[model samples]
Target: MKRLLLIGVLGLALGGCATPKYNYQAVSQNISKPAIGSVNEAYVGDKMLTQGVFMEREAYYVPEAKKKFLLNIPKGYYLKTGEDQKGSYYQPVNAIPDGAAFVGVQSVLITRDNSFCFVDVYFNKVCNFKNIGEKRKISVANDNSFQQTLIYSGKVGSKINVGYREFSSNLARPAFNNDVEYDLNESKTIGYKGALLEVIDANNQSITYKVLRNFNKVD
Candidate 1:
């Protein structure tokens, strides 16, 4: 048949061509590198500073005055005098606000280069945290959010944005107007009275306290 003749002719032509050879291998270009032990130094030379609002759940002494403002009432609708005091961006909370507990690692500055350095932050005069000096690890999300262990490194004059944490207020339906800062002139820290965050402005004179908010990261 004609089909048989076509197949015979195609086979003869195919036999005349050559087959190419190929190799399967992977090539890496990385050269030399130091061992992990080489990074072992007494310290990474960094400082840790934590900023957050201190919400005292009970009787605690705060240096900042708890201000009370009363609105003018003509009479009768049950006059609501200011029961709670408003604080600065360094806001305040009477007690740990219900659902707003968050922490952020912001900036890390090199404060000491010794074998061990004590880094602590205070809110008002109650909230305080102490972290060991080291390289902290963390996990990050696409939305620029992350959680991690805190680490510190840098020369004496370097500043690194590390982390931040917040304790939001839980006292309303919509749950708005919540802040994570302490009152100005507020001096206090965990079980002791001290300053949490000290901001010497560009003028080198103005001082203010700060609160750590959520949606922050160091990871």
Candidate 2:
């Protein structure tokens, strides 16, 4: 019995260690509330630069290295690394480590509206707008986490204008500007990727929908 208990305890410890740590900062106070078109443009820009600036998932940061490392762990926070290629933060320290692996976003200067937009390596959006982006982090405990609802704009005759969006991965473009028109008389169901929805009712200002199936990735 004692041996079995010890094995269970060890298994729990191993499982805890396997869980990934999230050291993200609180939402940014200055959120970038870009227009819908601007948001679409940002996604396209990210897709274009996917192979260039946001290419490397991880890089080594040496103090003597010619390229300057972009520190993105919020303003007051600090990122610390160990000699064993592991990163952790404790009390504040000044001395820079010799070789540190940078697993966060890459520093890419993207131009947006004559201003430089620092694209985050994670979501490919402006790094400073981390807080605004967190809205997309749906809670797994919520039933709506599996849903991909449509956004209603306006209706004209039999055409209904709606928008669809979903959280994007680092390797792909963010989903945006999926505004499409559906004919109410012809069909009440609409789909994107594998997410199916039934438009029960709609008007110029609002829409009522029934989620037929949860969202799935596009093949």
Pick by TM-score: which candidate is best? 2
- The list of candidate 2 runs beyond 4 A from truth reads 1-149, 169-177, 217-219
What TM value does model 2 have?
0.30
Which 10 consecutive residues of model 1 have the lowest summed lDDT?
Answer: 71-80
Question: lDDT per residue, candidate 2, 1-219, as tens digits?
Answer: 553353354331111111112443322111111211121122111220010111111111222222223332222212222111122221122122322333432332212222212322332323222121111111111111222334556778878776654432322234543767788899987666555667666666555565554443222
lDDT score, residue 180, model 2? 73
Angstrom error of the Cα, residue 61, model 2: value is 36
Tens-digit lDDT track for model 1 on 80-107? 1111122111112211112121122111
Which clashing pairs does model 2 show?
A: none
- The candidate scoring highest on lDDT is 2
